[model samples]
Target: MIRFDRVSKRYPPGLDALSDLSFEVAEREMAIVSGHSGAGKSTLLKLIAAVEKPTGGAVLVGGQNVGGLARSALPYLRRRIGMVFQDQKLLFDRSVFENVLLPLSIAGFPPRDAAQRVRAALDKVGLATREKALPIMLSGGEQQRLAIARAVVGRPNLLLADEPTAHLDRDTAADVARIFHQFHDVGVTILIATYAGELFPGARRLRLDHGKLMA
Candidate 1:
């Protein structure tokens, strides 16, 4: 569903974040991006999300060139992709349900429909009972699950997670991976950027080194 053709991005201060990175992620395929620090894995994810544009080449999603999308269309493109991060990125002030509903709210979905979707997403992430809780009140794993719920509440076609299991314990990391797999089983394309190979043994591994992909 996503392809990068000879893409490269270099910052102004002479730092090359990514170099000649080309890869394709098929629909419904779950893959892990593996690399050490400064290996360009996070840079790749940012490019896919359009948080930053490429300095060269193209980033194609479902045949549309995201690199060339109009500014007015960027939000629509991002709504089709869900992203989770190591920090969870939850708002301390909002209830879990409210946090999950932010995307729907931004899209101007009606209140009732947005609430229903939020509840469903929470249920999918096994956090149905925790909807009214605050982020500061939940455990680390629960907070991470909340992040996943927020990401998938939009029913995105592609899910990108960066260091998703970084702060969790072994069993919790395994649980989170299983949750991601469940999303994959039902047809969401999953691409995870992680350094923990042992945590994702069955996933297709794409190794990155020094801003370049390695075999």
Candidate 2:
């Protein structure tokens, strides 16, 4: 569902975040992007999501060229892809349900439909009972689960998570991993950027070093 054809991304200071990176993650496939800090894993995911454009080459999602898309067309493209950011990016002022509902609302989903979708997403992440709870009130792991719920509530065909399991107890990380496993079983294309490749052992690996794919 995602293809990077000779992609390169360079920052303002001539930092090459990704250099001629080429790879494909097929529809419904699970893959892990492994690399150390400054290895460009996050930039790769951003390119796929069209949050950042490539400096060169093409990023294709579902066969559509991401870099070539018009700004007005991005929302429709992004609706099919979910992202769980490294910071979780939850709104502390909102309740869990509201957080999950935000994406659908932004997409102009009807109020009734959005609420239903939000409830289902929370259930999937095992957070239904806590739907009314504020993000600040949740434990760290629960907060992480909340982020996952929000990402999937849009019913995205592809899910991209940046360091989903970082900074948590083993059991909590295991819990987060289990949630992703369920998503994979149901045929969501999954790509995760993480240092912990062992967390997703069955996933195919794409190793990056200094902005280049490692052999």
Candidate 3:
């Protein structure tokens, strides 16, 4: 559901984050973008999310060109895609339930339906009981799970994760990996950007070096 056609992102002063990067991620397929630090993996994710636009060529999602999407339409585009980052980025003052409900709330979902979906998302992430607790009270692993819950609470069509398991012990890292697989199993198209072989042990690998995608 994602297509990058000769996409390149350039910053000021002779720096290119990605150059001529091209790939297609079919609907419902889970793929990992593996690379070392400063290798453009995060840039790719940002391009797909429309947080940043390609300086050349196009970024297409579900057949719509996102490279030049108007600022007014960004929220609409974001609603269809969920993103999880290394840091949970949770609001410490809000209850976990409220944080998960934020997306639905922004979309104008009714309170009753929003609560139901929030609970379901928390359950999916194995954080049902912690819904009433603040983020600071949770462990790093639990905080990450809470982030996952927030990302998927809207049943988004695409999920983009960046270094989701960067923190935590091996077991908790495995738990995060399992959660990604579960989302994939349920037909959510997921693109995860992480270090080589970090979370996706058996999945197909796409290596990014410097700024170019290589086989």
Candidate 4:
């Protein structure tokens, strides 16, 4: 569950990334945010994740005000949310299994349980057989699946994906979309910011223009 109330984000030199934005995403729902470049899609996700704070109004996640969250509390907040960033941000030098395992290790999950969860995540993304391979060894779509596996290994409640299918061919993108649909079917709230929104025809649509919500 995420709610934004009159939120505005002003960067250095007073550039407004989002202006007077207000929206709500209910639990267990999937939504697609569509806009051209510079429409604040990424910034909106950053606000929910507490990587950036709004200059005005508030961003609330699961009823906790993210804008006012203490730095000490950020890790706790993030544990319940999974993010697939635009760049994929993989640990290229690490094995695929290690990349998926890193978050559990950091969160202090027990070794045995973490290992099981890592394997399950890979299976969900259809990457079970490639766990020992380095990221560089995978194809583009497989790498994207690897990123999704890493994001969900912790069983997060909310999944935020920024441009997940941007690089893939249509069929591969559709395959990736099916993976996300599987997670959503199991009750993970999904929010995707994408240029290829036709992949998610049934998701609630939120369009933006020039940093503001559009009708």
The 0-to-1 C-alpha lDDT of every candidate, in the order given, reads 0.91, 0.94, 0.91, 0.95
lDDT of 1 by residue, 107-133 (tens): 899999999999999998889999999
What is the alpha-carbon lDDT for the whole of candidate 3? 0.91
Please give each candidate's TM-score: 0.97, 0.98, 0.97, 0.99
- The numbered model that scores best in lDDT is 4
The residue-by-residue lDDT of candidate 4 on 1-215, one tens digit each, is 99999999999998999999999999999999999999999999999999999999999999999999989999989988999999999999899999999889989999999999999999999999999999999999999999999999999999999999998999999999999999999999999999998999789999988889998
Q: Candidate 3, TM-score vs. the true structure?
A: 0.97
Error of model 2, residue 79, in angstroms: 1.1
Model 3 per-residue lDDT tens digits across residues 1-215? 99999999998997999999899999999899988899999899999989998999899999999978999998999999998976767888999999999999999999999999999999999999999999999998899899999999999999999888886888998898999999998999999898736567656678899899998
Q: What is the model-wide C-alpha lDDT for candidate 1? A: 0.91
Candidate 1: misplaced stretches above 4 Å?
A: none
Superposed model 4: Cα runs more than 4 Å off? none
Give the C-alpha lDDT of model 4.
Answer: 0.95
Instruction: Give the clash count for each candidate.
Output: 0, 0, 0, 0
The regions of model 2 sitting more than 4 angstroms off are none
Worst 10 residues of 3 by lDDT: 195-204
